[model samples]
Target: MNLFKLFQDIEAVDGDATERLGYYSRRSLLRLGSKALAVSAPTVMASVLNEAYAQSSSVQDVLNYALTLEYLEDDYYQKGNAAANLIPAADKAIFTQIGKHETAHVALLRGALGSAAVAKPAFKYPAATFTDYQTFLLLAQAFEDTGVRAYKGQAGNLLGMDVLTTALQIHSVEARHASEVRRLRGLRGWVSATDEAPAPVYAGEAVTSQAGVDLVALTGKSADRVREAFDEPLDRAAVLAIAQPYL
Candidate 1:
């Protein structure tokens, strides 16, 4: 399909066709003058289309997916902070601030989605989740790590939209949260090959290759350095599955 018609189809599905049009723009299309599209290889265009459909069904769908995860995290932190002696007195402020950030994230996303926002889901936690400090820290690390991947996972869906910027700003904050939580757990601030906590969170995170380039071989970097240099992205389904037990 032609680019215009393809985006028209997307607009029909998610009402985001206008935004796509605005992003690509009629002027940009006019500059191509039809000749550019006419001579381009069919396989190349097909690959482009395939990537688009694989990314997401709709921008709203991706946002709702994120909203669900934020709901779970906000609920976890709020409950943990409220529990008596759950967070140590010295570390209380750290968790309290993180919880506030989660709450604010929920509010901001809800505001952005308005009527389109999904309702919060009930969460399940281990019996010792809040009673044991180690348990709380482990789960917190998992959630924060998962949040970082989840946000990166959704990047493809948010491309060419204004909301991508806001999502990325939130992403940086999640990265900071993950690093702090890891340090509190007596680990390095970055995800590494050695970090085996909650296997799924660290799944596909130890790769030393990116964009088909062997970072270790070409850059002469150690495997650990290569792996740690790039934070990996998880697809939507994998992220949701990691969150399933908690929901």
Candidate 2:
């Protein structure tokens, strides 16, 4: 898949690149309630990205990984939205909004990378992945939840404050998407211990400790409630494993 060409098509349909990029736009950066913040660099360089998993790193790798996820999400939602009689009338707007957010995320990450961006991988969804509304919602929940954890795992890799801030903003949005999808599935907004999946997306999330303080001991909260209170991060390897099937 020619990732650049796909981005170009989105740009063509959306007009101005800034608008297409959403929150990462220059104007939006200034409007982030802090006039001093801005993304000064255009391209974050391939070498920096190559060393991303080695502990300390640049924003390039994080943005590139995020962009890839955005691409997958955008394509998934677009396909789901396009499938005739697949989505309910009331739920159509939800998918539309989520699709727009994913598209904007793609534009933002691509614009940030400039020439250093990775090419979009050829995505292959399962034959029955989107055959019906329930199937589509389940997949959507998985993707959004995985995306939320993926971003959280990479948060420590971002070097720039501005970049980290942007990533957090996007992360919050993904969490919201996950919640929305879960609600559509008639499930709780957060993952429970009983939640079953091929991968450990919610692994270690049930712990109630932080900085040596146990929430269950401190606040008398149930383990499940504590788990729901905070979502765990998934390392790069885990995220890639979860995402590999789609790509």
Candidate 3:
């Protein structure tokens, strides 16, 4: 069947699935026709909704964009946990907790979007290789930092007061996540320090010097563009490109 039908089927089974949440084994789920009913699975549902529903005119579009990235990060962390060979044994639990948090973030954003939740699109990451734990931490740092800046950059796009406030709240949490991960990597002290580490400063401070600027696009750019650090706020298209590989 078509994608929309698949998502509908997934939602139809959600009541039963929610009852099984936290307890259902992957094998048991398969026994229950999980694969046959998988059209409504999270990623599939997202992809179908993305193609079927277009939020071209609503603030909901931006929220779904953020939700999509959250899904990607959530999935990536889970994959990392499964590939236990790549992640340290001691750190697997840490990664699992982070994955759960990312899942919660995605669910929250998706709920906020309500009827406007977009379908999930395919996503991927850069070809850059991660050589070791240090490299993985570095990349995690980059992803977390990007997430923080993205939320901040889109804060203005939210029109509802409640929506704006909620988004900002999540934005702050993302910054905290970035900070904690950075500390784990031995980059900084606790949140009170003034070290050269990367955490969300006020809107216009440096994010990261290396990926922070687009010098070629600097023809009379606003103060916001020149002063802030981190990779320039990734527009939806750029965000999708970074996300598609992981899907």
Best by TM-score: 1
Best candidate according to lDDT:
1
Query: Each prediction's Cα lDDT score?
Result: 0.82, 0.74, 0.58
In candidate 2, the residue pairs with backbone N, CA or C atoms under 3 Å apart (3 or more residues apart, or in different chains) clash, namely: none
Q: Which has the better lDDT: candidate 1, or candidate 2?
A: 1
Candidate 2 runs further than 4 Å off: 1-57
With candidate 1 superimposed using the best TM-score fit, by how many Å does residue 20's alpha carbon deviate from the native? 5.0
Candidate 3 local Cα displacement, residue 170, angstroms: 1.5
Tens-digit lDDT track of model 2 for 1-247: 5646744543432233324244344444455444334333323222222232232224556778888999999999988989988898999899999999999999888877777678877788988767777778878988999999999998886534456778899999999999898888888887766454544666656667877888888889798887788888998888888888888
**Could you give me the TM-score of model 2 versus the true structure?**
0.75
| Count of steric clashes across candidates, in order | 0, 0, 19
Residue 42's lDDT in candidate 3: 66
TM-score of each: 0.79, 0.75, 0.55
Write one digit per residue (lDDT tens) for candidate 1, span 1-247: 4768667555543454455445444445566567776665454445545545554356768778888989998999999999998888999999999999999999988876666689999889999998999999999999999999999998887776667877898889999999999999998899976557799888999898888999899999799988888899999889989999988
Q: Which candidate model has the greater TM-score, 1 or 2?
A: 1
lDDT for model 1: 0.82
